[model samples]
Each structure stands twice: as C-alpha cells, then as structure tokens.
Target: MNQKHLLACHERILPYIHRTPVLTSRWINERAGTEVFFKCENFQRGGAYKARGATNAVLQLTDTQKKNGVVTHSSGNFAQALSIAAKNVGAKAFIVMPLTAPKVKKDAVKAYGGNIIECEPTLKAREAMAEKIVREKEATFIHPSNDEQVIMGQGTACMELLEERPGLSAILIPVGGGGLAAGTSLAAYFFGTHCEVWGAEPFSVDDAYRSFKSGKIESNASTETIADGLRTQLGDRSFPIMKKYMKGIIRVEEAEIVETMRFVWERMKIIIEPSSAVALAAVFREKDKFRNKHIGVIISGGNVDLNNLPF
Candidate 1:
C-alpha cells in the first residue's frame, strides 16, 4: 500500500491495461464554472478503474495462489475486473454476484472464464455464498476493496492523472467502497499541486457522507438509485484512509447523477455510467466552490447497456 508499490504496479499494468485518456470539455468547464479535466477510466480495460487494482492483485499472486485460484463478490464491476485479470494470468476466478448485477458485467465475467455463483442482495448473503464456494473450490479470497494490495493498485489511477496534470487545484472521485477515493487521495497528495481530493457519492447510498459526519458507519435506509456501481459500503482498510486524506464526502441526488451522465455523454462524447457521473454531479451542484479553478475528476466504470438507460 505504499507509493513505491503503486509505482511498480503501473509498469506491470502498462502493457495489460489501456492508457485511458485525460479528456477536457469546454462545455463542462462553462457549466461547472471550473476548468475541468476528466480522467476517463470508463474507457479502461474491463470498463472500470477496478481493473487496475484487480490486475495488479492477480499479477502479483504467488505460484501457489495461481494454482489455488481466487474468489470474490461484486454487484458487477469488480467481478468482471477480477475475471479478466485472473484470465490474463491463467487463474480460475469464482465470482459470486447478485442476480441484480447488470447483464453486461455478468456476461463479461463468463466470457473471461469466471465461474459465477448467484447470491442474494445482502452483503451477508454474498459473503456466505463466497465463503462456501471458496471452501469447496479451494480458491483464494480476493476481497473487492479491503486488501492492502488492492488499495495500492487503486491509487495508481490518481498517480497517472496527477502525473498528467500536476497543477490541478482539486480532484473529484466517486466513492463506493472508498477504495478509489482513499487511494486517489494519497496519490494526489504525492504528485499533485497540494490538491484537495473530494469523494462524491449519490444521496441514495450516502453512507460515506453520514459516516464522515457521525464518525461511524451510517447505513442508508434503502438505496433505490440508478448508480448501481456505487452502492457498496466502505471497507475497513478504505474508511480509515479516506477519513485521513479526503476533504469530505459530497452526496449528490439520483437525479443529479442521471443528468450528469447524460450531459457527459452529449458534451464529452464519453459513455459513462451513473457512478462515474457523481463527480460531475458534485461540480454541477456546487459550481461556485469550483469556479475559476483547475479541477480534475475520475470518470469510473462504463459497463452500461445503452438501450436500458433510465434517463
């Protein structure tokens, strides 16, 4: 979970992953009142920044680990990430995903040689099934966000972005399990212009926001949001890091996320999912805060079925 490790991983992943571009939008800058630049991770391999962490984690696996294989649970993104990463290294990946996971993501996992196990929506249900499958199949457990290696790998995204734009005044990232936020904040501090990093989450699943204010895990009542990629809770490793480095969490409404997604599509010509749009939602909602400043945003996963967009 150190900078050296993250740097080393970037070299390893250079050949395997896409060098997703840092795109600028004049329309976004005018609308958000900030000179905005977006790190288009939605165009990344496996369709999300999760692929960076998943690839680094699997590539560093020991010979014994490769033979034993790995197991993990994801609503979608991380499962497909692990599946493709495991495939590149010739390891078996047992993916326990909810039936509610998007069909595109689930199909990607299958196409990548993943063994899918259906589970209920609850974390308890997913964990129970993943444990059973791991025990039966003798697969190593590759946690979605909690692992230190995964956190370090996730940090590399911010490294790449900050390296490309060192004068960034502030940065925005969508907060799901807080892995990306925590990792990106650390890397921003390392490479950027003393920039403040902010975590953006949909109000539908505003656990990180409440958790930051209340100083404890505050579970949302019921998350009915279009941002399916952002519904997961913060992990033990991620929460402490986010609490230390991140400025604070911004909770955007579901409508804001949808509108931002559509806006980014029409303006930037990028196909991003709702989770990716939360950063834009933050800027759109609080434009004055970002006025006349150099701002950066990480556009996350892009694994959406275009025909099925609720917007």
Candidate 2:
C-alpha cells in the first residue's frame, strides 16, 4: 500500500477505533539500555490493535456488501474486533473460531454481536467454515491479516506511534500473520525519520524469521507456543511488504516469552499478552545492538486468559 492509502485508512477508521496511548517505563529502559516507548494497543477497542483493521475493512464495504454482511476466521482478537466493528456499522459478522480458542475471546465475540461457528482447531477447518458461510450467506470474506485494507489499517498504529514519539531509531513488533509487521514497517518507512522496523516471533513458531532468511513465505512446523495469537502463517499481501521494509526478525524461546510477559506486568503494571511480550523479548535478545537507541514496541494486545496464564 502507498502512503496515501495508509493516511486515508487512519482517517477512515478514526471514528471507530481508539487512538491508544503510548507508555514508557524507566525500569524497562534501564534494563534494555535504551529509551523504549510502548504503543499500548492492549487498551484499544476489543483489547487489541486488530480493531483498527477490522473497522477500516467494514467501513469500506459497499451498501450491498454490508447488507450481505462479512465473514472471517480468527482464533481470538480479530474475531472480537470484526464483531465489534460490524456491530458498530449495523452489519452482521460471521466468525469461524477454532474450538481450541480461549473462552474469554469467544465470549467477547458473542458479546459484540457476532455469530460464532466453532470448528476443528485447524487452519483448514477455519478456512473451510468461513468459505462455507460465504457461499451460503453471500457474505464478503475478510481475511484477518491478508487483505489490503486490513494491512493499511494495521499500519495506523505505527503511524500514531511515530506522531507521538518521533526520531525513534527503530520499531519492534510481533509477527504472526505478518500484517502488523508489514504495516509497522511501512509506517516507519513513510512517517519516521530513518526509523528501521524489526519483527519478533516465538522460536516455536518462527516462520517469519525463516521466511526472511529464505526470501519466501514459509509455514510454521509447530503451533506449540504460549502466544496463541501468533500461531498463524504469513500471507501473500503481507510477506512482500515485510521482505522489503522489515530490518530483521528475532526469535525468542517460550520461556523468554513468559518471562517478558510477567516482567511487563510486574514492572510496567500493564497487562500484555505473550504475543506483545515477544517484541520486548527481542530487544532483550540483542541489547548490544539497540543500546542507547530510541525504540518503539507495539503492544499488539492484552486479551489474556486469566485462568490459564503461562506464568
């Protein structure tokens, strides 16, 4: 997407999404030996930054499309986001969620007026269900992280971050489907003054890292990670943007993800999911490289299952 598209998306979704706050912690800065800013999307609508993309996608639909409604498959955050966005626009949202998704997320989707369809906990099952809904209901399918509108909408978070904290040396974001990473990298390229963008992924699901090295989109061999929101693979729309704009990808272990989550909660006094912690863990993974530099970390979401915390 171009700068104009990104700017238009930020304006289009402004009324639907929250302009989440940016936070900083002296303890975290000292530990990382850098001035780190946290773009807290955890406090956003639906408790995630996905609201930005979902809202943008829904608002752009034609009248006929809105009447037919929208369909998507997501494990959690995007499901809640699309539900809330659709409800705000008086459109129906059919969400195909895996049976293994967190109950809290499922409840949030229902509360937001989405029709939930549970399926086997597999990508194939989720996509098949979504496709079936599209055929039966004549609904428009919005891929959670693959659509052009969604990617532009996701970039607005980084755009806001740069507006608040200019001159940042780099930005670190968690990579799951690569939408947010691609968007963040584009925002850094267009808005920041020479700011580099990096991605963080769990070693258990390090497809983004492998893909970066191989110069092609790659799939994860294992989905065994505490960062449940990050278990998906990258898409065609997002991969090319990431390949061109992202500086690198850092892979952190499961233990590192858990420790970073707890550290943020204990020190920053904010609830961040494991997916969000992946970014901070990357900074810690190579402190020497980022020493004394101004860095921005996008806190992707805070939809944690209190009963099943990794800590």
Alpha-carbon runs more than 4 Å astray in model 2: none
lDDT tens per residue, model 2, 67-141:
999999999999999999999989999999999999999999999999999999999999999999999999999
Highest-TM-score candidate: 2
Off by over 4 Å in 1: none
Query: What are the lDDT scores of the predictions, listed in order?
Result: 0.86, 0.94
TM-score of candidate 1 on Cα atoms, chains taken together: 0.97
TM-score of each: 0.97, 0.99
As for candidate 1, its clashing pairs are: none
